[model samples]
Target: MIETIFRTVDVPAEHRFEAMRENMTNVHAPAHLSSAHAIDFSAEMRLVRLGRLCVWPATVQPARMWRTPRLIRQSDPEQYHLTLMLRGTKRCMLTGRQFGPHEMHMTDTSQPYEVEVVDDHGEIKMIGVEFPKALLPLPADQVNRVVNRRLPGQQGIGVLLTSFLTGLTRHTGCYRPSDGPRLETVLTDLFSAVLAHHLDAETALSPETPQRTLMLRIRSHIRQRLHDQELTPATVAAAHHISTSYLHRLFRNHAHDSDHEGTTVAAWIRHQRLEAARRDLADPAQHAIPVHHIGLRWGFSHHAAFTRAFRSVYGMPPRDYRHATCRPAGPAH
Candidate 1:
């Protein structure tokens, strides 16, 4: 049930200026449109919504647009529209810079800002993800810094987000209706992760923000070392430049009502190691490998310990789970 919702308009030569103006308004926030040749203007807006997020993919010709004070006085969506240039160029007065392909910028529709597309023939394409301003859940000051400025989308989470969005737009029909909540959560979290990385927000966000941020970082670190026999709380904390006590506190804050009731940080490492072991056990390429060898690869100290841990989590030992999941080999090739 991937829903594809789109809007398009081709402003006639007779009413190009006026019609283009209206089209631009609906594409984002209301704005004033001015162009020497607005005639034969063309624009198309493709939107895919997973819950409240509107993935507005836009393509249009050259024009000068502004979110003026007067326009804000009349109407405003108070949304943050993050734009990534797919092709062509743009000059923004707010940031006083030019954005070329693959670079991103954020525009707060609630504020007064102006931009001009640089394409002489008036053809440009880009993706704009509109986030409800009230729902961003980020520090206003930090958001402002990244809003008008160009942010890199070629590295780290930016790369992941850019690839996700590129694929998302290309495969909008593949998403199921039931995927709304999960997709919405992914978009929000990815957005938060990107902006937080830019803002160095681990220290700037609220108490809970740092805790959540730390856990995410810690988890990534743990995943990379699931096979390390010495991946204890102390080692994990030292690698992250935090104390062992503080590391335990992170998982605690993220867990049960009583800090003592939830699984300790050390236990989480063990569980993750066992989970990795089970995955290796199920992998067809590793079928010839011994089960105990797989356990040792994932840091299990003994055959019995790995078996017990695997059974506790999956209601069966590693070998049994693999037997149940792995299909028999068919005729060669």
Candidate 2:
């Protein structure tokens, strides 16, 4: 199961910053943490354990954290820390870099570094993943080339990695402890792919990596185009330059690893479309949108078909589902 490693709200206000520092040290590596506004510090962090790799999703107050050469010698986890900035900016003097929203930075625990993250108006939101340096399939020299470098999270393999990280963080309840090994394999492959792509060292990845990475890319592609009415197995396969039969086999290859009911391409698309329409139906802000219109937006062309499909999965028609979850606006106060 995933863990909520820390929440400032659980600690006394005066001690929250101190608690955060201690938790960070334990979770990642030893470092000194200080904040100009420590009295009002607040944050909530969740730790998702994927086998030997761990991801930390947090929204924290402005603070400065640094590791010295002395601290590195004292206790080095010998881990690589990859951090994605979701909603703030951070400046690092050692790397001579500034990362804005949607950018990522990598750090080595064996080296000294310093970072100051801030958002003057609110808290800083970030997700960080740490794994043993030895777990990466590439050589240490190749890995060293990319450390302290800024990686963009908005494109290519980076998109796949960021999506997987954020999805895991947001839906921890959907996974079980037993799912750790499978999730870890996917996480490691994607991380390796991202690093390899940056270093022009794709050939260094293991033989199984390309197939797994391709599957992840296919899934990501399918998700982004779920709203299109033409989304189907053929269209999806064409986009990826693969045959439809090959796509089916790809899904078949991993059927046992997933708890999802469907493994075929058509089934996967239908499931995604239904889940998306279901969220829109339950959303209060979308209540003003008609049920059939919401269905159409997610590729369900017919009202009766949409109702039948939605009811089959959700145990109720879209209208009833909406009514049960969304209270009608009481007369505007």
Candidate 3:
């Protein structure tokens, strides 16, 4: 679970806004914050810290937050704040843009900017990440091109980054402290790809950035099409317009040998398919679905084949696994 480092629910309603404001400036960059509903404000912040990057998912009352020249002089983290709005609307004076749910906007903490909820009343829900400017792998001036600009999170690399942040918020406890460095790398690459795409500067990225970015794109493609029985390495390569050999090479270079032997493209595909089926088997809501149908849904052509694969990984047949984990369909207590 993501850690609730700061939450206003426990504080007196009259003091909740001030508590939130204090935590924000202390944990993030220095900024001035105010809310029209301070007397009855309610908010929550869930945070996860990766190496040099930190993500915070917040549910906050309508408020105005800004950094002025004076605030900048007082303190500057020299970080970039990328906010993915999950609900409500916001207006940013830095880019002269207004955005709402499923859209993203970025700001450089080194510069003065204003970000305020434009809604007359309601909570503004957003997930944000702050990372040092040096982690971007691009020149500061080039990165400024997107500062506070409305970015499309519904399509392209923006979708991947947004999905990643959303997943992290939901499953933060699934990770260990040792995972920080790798998670940091993945976030940096995805963030870099989004910024580079907007600037038309893909070639400006560091040598390792493109390879890591391509691997992520490939993994995403594979996951999306796992239901297709024809989703072989060759077909996957064709979809991405790369040769099958090159795809195999990419997998070999990036395979997680420390865990399982998913060193080949075919093995990776099978593993993902089995994992999907496993999740369905464990879901109580899906317990009524036939074991064979669950297998077929995830690209296993025959019941026996699915059983063998599932047992090989999970040490039990799908039906038995489901029986052990899922209770009979009935009313909740």
Candidate 4:
């Protein structure tokens, strides 16, 4: 299951310092400054973790200003941070670049950066989406040029980017693991569109960037064959009329370049199968089907292998995952 972290900060006149300090610690804020307010001040931040990505929404009130000092630092497992302002104003500076308001910017946590939040008696609201750098298809040099720099959000691709983000934030919960593949596609397109717009090089992009078209096709094919126990690189390559070497190249180019990258195709197939099995296990409509049958239906030939894979992926064996998901909230008393 996905994990979500929600935090709220309300600082009365007397305890404002304490509240601010606590919030800073929570966000791993490098440094902060606040002005004395006659009235109370408050802020709210919500963080949602989806596999390798994280989304955060922040709101602040009573016109207090917060800044990260030069010496402050922060780190994360994520590769990039995208910040979009929903309401009010915020300015972030990194590598001598600045971004604010309707504009969007990306930050590399490995480097030192500062964000200035200015309320000025008004409210401030912002949303931040963080994901792995590998998820983006752009070259490192091109990506570097855009990072920490404010991109225009006034017309054309900017409008599309804004609309997509708004919709994504509002409707994320409606998506299920079965929908993960689709969501990943949408994210790829949105990121591509945004980058192409900023670089003024949309026309320069190839008809099939490996990360965009090729990987997408491979993932779609994998999802369709999740129920086929014989699915393998050889079979998949044959289906696509491509050589196994070509298939391996595609996976290596799109996924990370780690030792695990060699097994990505198989890993992807297993992930989809596990997701399908989990759904079937929790679904009352399928309660009549034996767990072993459900595993078989999702392409697991060996019950033992399925049990081990299910446990490794979901932190429990099939029966245990089903029982927990199917359990009642509590006794009525």
Q: If scored against the real structure, what TM-score would every candidate get?
A: 0.60, 0.89, 0.92, 0.50
Question: Which candidate leads in lDDT?
Answer: 2
Q: List the residue pairs that clash in candidate 1.
A: 61-122, 62-122
Which 10-residue window in model 3 sums to the lowest lDDT?
253-262
TM-score of the candidate numbered 4? 0.50
> lDDT of candidate 1?
0.74
- What's model 2's lDDT at 55? 91
- For model 2, how does the per-residue alpha-carbon lDDT over 1-333 read when each residue is reduced to its tens digit? 456678989999889888898899989998999888788688888888888888999988889999999999999999999999999898887866999888899989998999989897878999999979888999988899998898999987898888888888888886878888888888888899999999999999998788889999888888888888898899989999999899899899976555556989888888989988887887888889999999998888899998998899889999999999986565767
Tell me how candidate 3 scores on lDDT. Answer: 0.85
* Cα distance off (Å), candidate 1, residue 227: 23
Question: For candidate 4, lDDT tens digit of each residue in 142-207?
Answer: 876777777666565565556556655665675665444545555556666677767876664555
Per-residue lDDT, model 3, residue 310, is: 92
Query: Which candidate leads in TM-score?
Result: 3
Q: Candidate 1, after superposition: displacement of residue 120 in Å? A: 5.4
- Candidate ranking under lDDT, highest first, comes to 2, 3, 1, 4
What residue runs in model 4 are displaced by over 4 Å at the alpha carbon? 1-5, 9-41, 62-78, 93-100, 200-333
Model 3: which residue pairs collide? 1-173, 106-148
Q: What is the C-alpha lDDT of each candidate?
A: 0.74, 0.88, 0.85, 0.64
RMSD of each: 7.9, 2.5, 2.2, 9.8
